[model samples]
Structure formats: structure tokens, C-alpha cells
Target: MWIVLLLPIVAYIFIQIAFCRVKSQSKYLRNVPGKRPFLIFGNLLDFLPGSIVFLDNLMGYLKTYGDTILFHDGSFSWILLSIDYEFNEFLYSSSVHIEKSDQYQFFHGWFGQGLLTSSGSTWRNHRKVITHSFHFSILLQFIDVFDSVGDNLVKKLESEAGKDSVEISQLISLYALDVICEAAMGVKIQALEAGNSEYVKSIKEMCNIVVDRVFSFISPRLYKLTWTYYREKTALKVRGFVLA
Candidate 1:
């Protein structure tokens, strides 16, 4: 009796997989040669976890294949990826395609309607206003800010000179972050001196959380079910820092 019951369930699983495989191959995308997708998983099984490896996987795929490749997530959504530099440059710079990708809207919760995520006229208006800030004369004002951050970094490196080689990547990243905060935000965070800042910790956490959601097989909104409490907590911390 146990064998009889298990046989039907096993058969059902195979049937579902077959159905999903068939459905995954779209009429338009069928022309592109790529990996076969699985039910509710798509090509997710083929990717390494986290944002960094996920991007590497794409570049690897592009290298293995040609410029155009088909990619899918779960059952419903499909992406026609293009690696051709000229084609992508035209797509990005063309006035007609001003809207950011669907994934960008997820960042709206953290960044608000600023340049990277905003769309339509709001983005155009912000672009116009912020473009002037990049003028040569205006940018010349930030030289002092760069010098200040660079001087502190040199002093920090000199202090650690005789010791074993330090990870300059993190140290320089912290310094660059401090420069951006001072120059762009007009706030002197002095993040290098602060060492472990609550804002820095929270923002880093927020970025990782966002990257996970972006690559998730399911909808990004679904992350709220698991991370709502944590998301709110971090958002409050970021808002507190910005508001202050």
C-alpha cells in the first residue's frame, strides 16, 4: 500500500517538472540557446548566491554564449540580456528609455526619489537640477574635502606602516565614503575615525538585504513577510542619521 501511494506522488513530481520545462521555453526566447529552467526555480540553481557571484555568473554566461542571452526567474518573468557595449550604451543613453529597471523600484524605500531610482518627469527634473552641480567651477570647491580625507588616510597608513600589510581596500573605502558624505551631503561624518558607526552598519545591512531581494526567485515585496521588522528598524536608523 505504501509503494502504491508513493508511486503516484513520484509520478506527479516528474509530470510537474516536465510541464514547467515546457512552459519555461517561451516562443520568443526559444531562439536563444541557454540553460533549461526548473519549476519555481528557473536558472536559480545555476547561480551562486549573493549579488557579487550573481553578476559574475551573468558575465560568465555572456562570455560562454554570445552578446544576447535569455534569462528567467521562477516561472513568469524572463529577461533578454545583452552584453554588447554599443547596444547597451545606446539603450542607456537614449532619451526614450529613461525608466529604470523594475528592480530599481525596490531601492525607492531607502533612497527616496533621487536620480538612480526615480522615473518619468520627476527624474528628468532632478537630473536637470543636479546636472548643474557637476559644473567645473562647482566641482572645484570639493578639492579641499578630497585633500582633507586623503591627508587623514596617509596619516592612518603611516601609523600602521611597520605592521603586517593592512587591508587597504576597506580603509580606502571608508575614507572615500567620508569624502562623499562631506562633499555631497555637506555633512562631515568622519567615518574613518568613528570606526564602527551605527549608520554605516545599518546601511551595509540594508544594501545586502536589497541585493538578496533583487535576486530572489519570488517577488521582492514578499521579502517584507520575512524582513518587515528588520527593514523598519534599519530604515529608522538611516532616516535618523539623514534627518540629524
Candidate 2:
């Protein structure tokens, strides 16, 4: 039993070492210079728990590797192209070559095939419809709608400020939600007024949960199988409330 367990463990270690060596060797073959990626985990382990550290690590890599760097996340490889005039021009010059990556399929559950997530001809058609709907004259007609929402937000904040130094971040978020609901759906959520309004609470909780799931190593398919009571139930309720 001891021999059997030890043999498997040893073999696993050997395989991991070999994979690391092969990945490291590939750096030499490539035209650019980059830090050799670690085996299996790659550079992901360095920033596994949070994005702040991940961003810091990426900045450090940028300092060392210059603007353009190649890195691997799990089995997925990507090129980090820092912003430059030439790169911006190349990106905006053509819609044909600037298609969404295959990795975006993972977000299907969150956004469905909506305009933000859709691509190719479907995206083009959606863009045309939205553009026509928001023509200059149409937008100009909504000036009162915009002004009313802004005034409501300023009044709400003035009332809240009398109590104590408000948590500006939370207040701003609630204000934004109220504004969007009134502007887009023609529904007043009044999230800023109620403070603990169910819709506002649910939206914030859902956003936090989604962010947590995205940063984790959990399989994207697993999110499809599992539904949190907070997100699913609240989403259904909110949708009904909004549509009503």
C-alpha cells in the first residue's frame, strides 16, 4: 500500500516537472522574452486569491517584459498588448478581425447572447437597431428624464449627509441603480431612499457572487449546474417586478 501510494505521487511530481521544463524551453523558441511559466498552475498561483495582487504581478511583469508579453493562464495562452497609438488604430480600423475570443463562451450564462456578448453579424444588426433608437433628436427629448433623475440623487444625498459622513461608495452605487432603472426601464427603484430595498440588495449580492465566481478556478460549466438561492430567486423576482 505504501509503495503504491508513493509511486503515484512520485510519478505526478515527475510529470509536473517535465511540463514546467517543456513550457520553459518554449520561451527560447519564441521571439520575445518572458518569465518562464510555472507548471500546471502557471502564474495563476501568484494571484490566486484576489485580483489586486494579480494586477500588481501583471504590472511587475510589464516592467520586466515591456509593453507586449505572452503569458499562460491554465491551458489558455494570451498576449498582453499594452495600450499604444498603433495598437489602438489597428484595433479600431477593422471590425472583421476584431472578433470576440472563444473564451467569452464561458459568460453565456451571465449575459446570454445579448448585445454586449454577441458578435459578428448578430452584433452588427443589434448595434444598428440601438443606434437608430438613440438618434440625436430622440436623446434630446429625454433631457427632462435625465434632469429629474439627477435632481432626485442630489436631494437624496443632501438628506443622508445630515445624519453623518455617508459611505460615499455605497450611496453612489445605489444612486446609479436608481438612475438606470428610471432612465432605461421607466421604473423607479428608489434604492437610495429605502437603503435596504430588496431589488438593490439582490443586485449588489448577485454582482458580488458573480465577481467571486469569475476569479476562482471553478469550472464555468459548474456555474450552469449550480444556482445560488440569493441570485436565482432574486433575479426572477426582480425581473417580474421590473416587467410589471
Candidate 3:
């Protein structure tokens, strides 16, 4: 009976001791400033529920914390956002730190071990293979593709000039994508000419799913349970498009 009554008290004391240890360890982060992560929750409360609002909050937080900030979601993870020019150069130039972070593995389902999410020998090999495609001669050849896409974009813009303030954002996105399709994928998506492509629509949905996955605190569980449906659906559509 006494042990049962004291369970809550014992757990309470243990939690307090744990928090004290964590608070003491906070000094190890040094001059880096960020949200005060609470026990269990960490900085989960710092994140907004919606992607748009979360981005707004992130920008606001960055404004307050400067270019560099310690982003903590839980005791399990912490990311140091180093946005300064010199710091970014140092981070990317280092061969030792070439490994992608653990969080990037979450995106593996979408991109697999492709160049963007790969590391070590796999990444090195992928880089070598991809670099060949971007060789100076190959890039020079791609200039014609870029010019065609740009001309198409200009024609679309000119057509919209007489309209009451047309949105050029979609046109610009399609133009950029057209360039990428031709230069990188070795295919012509013709997204701008198509106007309403199923593949393009799927791509947009995939972007929204990615944003939700990346920004949410419960990314792993959320992705597998809810986000995975749209992700897989869109992924299948993209694959179908590529195969076609």
C-alpha cells in the first residue's frame, strides 16, 4: 500500500533530478541561443501547428535569434542552424562532416539514397556520376534547352500582360521545372505548354506533403500513418510520368 502511494512521489523526484541534469548540461551549448526546451516536450511547443504559421514563427524566431540558432525539438534531437556565409562555407567544405543528419533519413522514402539524401561512399559515387552530366560541354548543350524554356515563359508573361494582374509565380515555377527536366532528367516535361499536367499537379501535392513532414514535430508517426498516403500516391504518379 505504501509503495503504491509513493509511486507518484518517486517518479516526481526522478523527473526533477533529470531536469536539473539537463539544465546543468545546457551550458555545453555555449553562446548559442534558442527556445527553452522543456522536459519530454523539449521545444515542441515552439512550433506552430500549421506549415504556413510554422514558417512565419520560424522566420520570427530567426529574426530574434540571428542567423545561427540552436533548434531543439526533443532531447532526442538538436540542430544548429548556421546561416552565416562563412559558417555555411565551412560546413559544406568539410569532408569529415559529409554525412547527412538523422532527420534526412525521414525523407529516404521519398528520395531514397539519391544524391540529396545519400552519404559517405554512396554519396561520393552518386556525386561522381551526376557531375558527369553537368560537365562543361554538356552544360553548354543545355543552353538551348534553357533558352527555349525562357522563351516559352516570356510568351506566357506577354499573354498575361493584358490581364488584371496575372500571377507569374506558376509560370516561373514551370519554366524552372522545364529547365530541370531537360538538363537533369534528360526529358522534356513541357509543364508550361501542358497548362494542367497530372504529373505537375502531383508534384505540387508532394511538395505540400514534404513541407508537412519536414516541419511537424511528429514527422515520423505522422508520415507513416497519415502523410504516407498522399506521399505514396503522388510518388506513384511521378513514377508513371517518368516511365511514360
RMSD of 1: 5.8
| Positional deviation of residue 61's Cα in model 3 after best superposition, in angstroms | 1.8
Which runs in model 3 stand beyond 4 Å of their true positions?
1-28, 49-51, 163-166, 219-223
Candidate 3 per-residue lDDT, tens place, 66-176, comes to: 898887665345667867899899988777788897677766765779888989998888887887776688778789888988999999999889988977888888888
Question: Which residue runs of candidate 1 sit more than 4 Å off their true CA positions?
Answer: 1-34, 51-56, 66-70, 79-84, 159-165
Per-model TM-score, in order, reads 0.75, 0.67, 0.77
lDDT by candidate, in order shown: 0.75, 0.66, 0.75
Candidate 1 has its poorest 10 consecutive residues by lDDT at: 44-53
- Report the Cα RMSD per candidate: 5.8, 5.6, 4.6
Instruction: Extract clashing residue pairs from model 2.
Output: none
Clashes of 3: 0
What ranking emerges by TM-score with the best candidate at the front?
A: 3, 1, 2
**Across residues 160-230, which tens digit of lDDT does each residue of candidate 1 receive?**
89998898877887898899999988998887888668766776677776666555755555656676547
lDDT of 3 at 97: 83
